[model samples]
Target: MLYVFLSICCSVIVSILLKLARRYSIDISQAITWNYSMAILLTWLFFKPQFQNLQAAPIGIYTAVGLLLPLVFWIMASSVRVAGIVRTDVAQRLSLFIPLLASFLVFGEALTPLKIAGIIVGFAAILCSIPWQKKTANRKVISNAWMYLVVVFFGFGAIDILFKKVAAFREIPYTTSLFFIYSLAFIIALTGLLIRVFNRKARIVWPHIMFGLILGVANFGNILFYLRAHKALASNPSAVFSAMNIGVITVGTLVGVFVFNERLSLVNKIGIGLAIVAIILITLSQH
Candidate 1:
């Protein structure tokens, strides 16, 4: 449970840093590029993963995750900036519904009654969490923050599915696969950064590098601690799953509302509650 607590902190801290990036004028692209560098370094240092099984690795899934990670990360950053932490986190946590749906629709798994109920509630939660911009007298509604939230919801869910695919591939050790995926992701991110620099749309700023290093630590810590929690609670996988999702939403809401003073509509509040209930149902269905 301690690992779960730390993981929750790291997850929310990542969002807080992303929220702060806007105020600091940080180039999220550059920061995200450098973030993979740190992740690569830590993965190698901590896991000491072997690359001898590269030929057996699932390159297709690796490539997909490599492409999506930075893109979704930037979108999540934009979401935190525009939509506020409360709604963005709720949307993210509810994304678990995607994999559950995939089990039924794509993998031919039977859907239990609880899963069906959870899916219904989870869909409602997503709709409620959308940060709908109110119409002004001039009707000049400018914020498309809800779009970012919607993208984040689906994007992370896709990433999660890819990760599960990687995990199921037994030819390569999971840590080694992770190391290779991070390497590929770093290359992809670096390529995008170079293109931006070439186009004169961005520069190699020092602040982004520093912030990226810190963000990478928090991001990696979230993964590390969550894995630790699962390993420690191997007999009860549902506990880890439910605790992580519920914890992030709970902690993120408190920080967003109290520390950042983020305001949520009554409907959004209802969405957050439904999100928790949906996760509970999903976890129960697994049992």
Candidate 2:
């Protein structure tokens, strides 16, 4: 339970850090590239020996996970830029329903009435949270970047489902799988950095770079802890993941309101309520 709580807290911190990174004029792509590099290094330092006994298939699984890291971060950051944090987050969280459905249909996971209710409510909340409006006479309402948010939703949902499927395979240690994935992500991201450097646009702001490094360590720590919790409580990892989302949304909302002074409209307030209810339902359904 403590591990679960800590994992949720750490995940929330990732979002806060990303928001702060935005304030510093950081290049999100460069920061993410560096972040994965740092994560791979730190994870290897702590867990490299654990991989010695793993079978080959888990290595491929981990590599797949690594390939997803950049896609997830890039789309998420673009979503934040286009849709604002609140809406972007709501969409991201609600997107987990896709995996939940997949778990049921593909993995024979049972969906209780409460889980179904939660999914419906969560989806409704996400829809309510979106800020749709007509374009002004002189300005476009929805930017092209908003498409990235949709990608974030679908891509991340697929990633989560894949992770769960890999975890269920049981032939390899979870830590071994994670290490391979992070290492692969690092290689891919480094290649991207090299390409960017050749383009002469790869400026590394030291502060953002260091922050990304710290965030990388923290991100891997969260994954390590969550994997532990999932191992211990394998019957319902999705429930734990949903709880983490609740923590992220709660902390992110507070930061947006008090720290960033972002305004919440009446619709957003209602959406928050619905999101809370959805999380509660999802959690309860795990029983």
Give the CA lDDT, 0 to 100, for residue 68 in model 2. 87
- Pairs that collide in candidate 1 are none
Question: Per-residue lDDT for 1-287 in model 1, tens only?
Answer: 99999999999999999999988999998999999999999999988998686787778899999999999999999889878898889988988888888988999999889999999999999998897766356544547888998999999999999999999998788888888888898999999999999999999988999999999999989999999999999999899999999999999999999999887889989999999999999999998
Q: What does the lDDT read for residue 38 in candidate 2?
A: 81
**Candidate 1 least-lDDT 10 residues:** 133-142
lDDT of 2: 0.73
Candidate 1 error regions (>4 Å): 135-142
Candidate that scores best on TM-score: 1
Clashing pairs in 2: none
- Clash count list over all predictions: 0, 0
